[model samples]
Target: MSEQSTTDSIVSFVLENKLKTILYTWAAGITGSLAYEWSRPIPGSLKIIHSRVYAQAITLAALGSVAAVEMYQATHHPDKVKKVDKHGY
Candidate 1:
């Protein structure tokens, strides 16, 4: 297989796995949010660590809620799920 096809197949495999997608989403959201929060100055009473924890918790909660909703829709309303192309567009 060519390099492009290999890359595409790897991405396709990741997208096809719901658990992997959820874990990836959580990891990305948590790390991205933590980085953003850490870069900002700590507000009034909150410490830097507290702000980081808050960011991580909120990110995880939000992403978890979204994943739960998507899973629910997939299970109960399979027809409503959007289909993706081979490239995951």
Candidate 2:
């Protein structure tokens, strides 16, 4: 039996859990951006906490939109999804 390499395993995982991977990636990007912004010197009287909250809200909204689109596709075009499931893209 041939064993899959680490790269192959990681690729398979990402492909199989595409939505989850996307969410994680999106969240990571948001967090990184926020971290960078925070690292900069704070402007006098500016509220960083509000900005963080807004960023989180935006991320959640974007995630919800993606999930809704995915659901719509799965329901409206199930055959296409099935084909992908049977044969990896």
Candidate 3:
């Protein structure tokens, strides 16, 4: 097979694995949020469970944002990189 077709096949494989893809996206957000919260100093008076819930909410929001970008990327190719770069820099 040609190089372009091989690359296309790999992308197709990832797109087809719906459940794994979703878990990965959400996991990324959860990990990122947890790390962010860990590095900051919070009041000790706050309940641990409440803090955990807040962290999870932050993670969910991040995951939603990522999912939206991925959905937009799927509908609009070639332009995806431009959109990411515009936001990144």
Give Cα-based local distance difference scores for all models. Answer: 0.62, 0.62, 0.56
Q: TM per model?
A: 0.43, 0.47, 0.43
Q: Candidate 3 residues 1-89, lDDT tens each?
A: 45657655545545455456556655665566566656667754344444567656755765575566556547766453333364643
Can you write out model 2's per-residue Cα lDDT over 20-63, one digit (the tens) per residue? 86677666756775666676788623435645665677667656
List model 1 lDDT by residue over 20-57, tens digit each.
Answer: 66566657765776677667777634554665676567
After superposition, which runs of candidate 3 have C-alpha atoms over 4 Å from their true positions? 5-10, 43-89
Best by TM-score: 2
Model 1 clash count equals 0
lDDT for model 3, on a 0 to 1 scale? Answer: 0.56
Residue 52 displacement (Å), model 1: 1.7
Error of 2 at 15 (Å): 1.1
Query: Which is the better candidate, 1 or 3, if ranked by lDDT?
Result: 1
